[model samples]
Target: MKRCAALCAGVGMLAVLAGCSGTPEETPVASSPSTIGTTSAPAPAASVPPAGPLGSAAYQAELTKLEQSLAGPLRTLTRVRTAEGLTEAMTTLADSLDAASSQLADLTVTRRLTAVHEVLQDSLGSAAETLSNSDRTEANARCGGVAYTSQKVQRQLRADLSGATVPLDRLGLKFGGTLPDPGPEPKPVRPSNGAIVIRSGPTGTGRLKITNGTANDVAVSIVTDGKPPAKPHVMMYIQAGKAATISRIGGAYHIYFKSGADWSPTRRQFGEDCSFQKFEQAFGRNESWQVNLEPTLGGNAKTTEVEAY
Candidate 1:
């Protein structure tokens, strides 16, 4: 009985092992390849409408009036003065014309007449100033003062003109229709990058050095707090290296430097770089050696007492 029971148990185990073996999973079937080819449509092209007439009858009439107004004066100026003056006069005339032109230029397109007008006006004003001044030096000095102010004015005008022109150009195209060939594209403006360094001279007599580390040439000015010492002379020297020398009897305090042809005051300031109360004379680039600050304050003063180089 025991042998029979053991044999039965082994058969049961075999049956269990056979049940564990299962059927293999079926592989998925893919669909047939499609016969249709890719249908990529071409992109639609931009439709440009044909150009129409340039200006309205009213606009044309106004332009004619401006041309007449400017012509005689411009021609007279051209004949009498140097080329510089002639150029200025012509520019002014062109600007005036542009101002008139802009009124029509926008029939709804881009108009730059206002900008042109402003530039011309400025050029005319500067020219007039130069003509009235006693000498070139005075004229140049006046011109410098006007430069920044005039630039700001022109920019404002340009913005206003642009606002007017865009709508006009469009209106003309949509309604009155047609214009002369579009004016030239605006010239691209390239930005500049650079740095300016101002160094003060030694104690009794000192010099200031300006270095132009930029691609373009720049102008600079030197100023001192309070009246300069008697015989006070402040000189400027420029180029790649070394500060200018100032020869003075007394030391100067609170020295300042201004940058640009416009001479805007810079952050650089000196308190006690040199011990003396003032400098004596203006120095220029011709002198290579920097003025010594040590002697101005007396023997005991530290070199640091002079302005930080």
Candidate 2:
């Protein structure tokens, strides 16, 4: 019963969820008895300069950019429940984390404020690695790792000289399941043929029912055309032999499911004619659908109409 409408809409406000050093200075080159006499100066104090810099105004600006980079990707990573969605979201998240972690290493700060930055660097990196490399069946179940890790970075926003507040409050970010948590891990659903995609958006509030019948897990991608510049709006995860609900959705859109790896060999898409606007108007208000993946004789997934409400 993990719900939807939380990805980019933001019922209230904000957003993921972090990152080098210079070589040691040559010991004040001993005069080797030659330069030592050059200056009537006391022998230069021998010391190794600190490796990294402390936080600064410039550092704060860099934090701001990292904050922005993390917002969309973190939200997507937390909300997306499908294998493909997880893969896509993690891919995006990893890119942002990679940027943050890499940049964090090179910044030359005074006093070396490494603790906070390292917390974020490790969290984002760990979360991204889990999503990117974990087995497909296990990826969605591991989303909790992404949530709490990013939340740690979120809590440090205002405290940091960056003083990141606006983004922190939005998305209603929190820990311990304040955000929707996927139910018990589901069994993999495998559609012998291919899965189905049904696009819908209820006028006010509506729920979407997606059922995956096969033994392998299926991931759903929903995109809306209600406004121009259509983008991926919501993503759902349906485990094998499991049914999940997208409790809230509003607008017009189409969806496509990544059945088993069978579709990996070729690309597939849904037509605009399938927009739920047609049905919402025809049926008036509340609209729901049952998307079932039926296997085909060939080693492929085929699209078919199930039922709509």
lDDT of 1 by residue, 92-121 (tens): 434443333333322221132333323323
lDDT of 2 by residue, 138-220 (tens): 33223223333233233332233222232322322221122223443223233332233333444345445655656655556
Model 2: residues with Cα > 4 Å off, grouped in runs: 1-56, 78-82, 137-309
Q: Kindly provide the TM-score of model 2 when superposed on the true structure, using C-alpha atoms.
A: 0.30
Candidate lDDT values, in order: 0.29, 0.39
lDDT of candidate 1?
0.29
Winning model by TM-score? 2
For all predictions, the C-alpha RMSD in Å is 34.6, 19.9
TM-score of each: 0.25, 0.30
Worst 10 residues of 2 by lDDT: 12-21
Tell how far residue 155 is off in model 1, in angstroms: 15
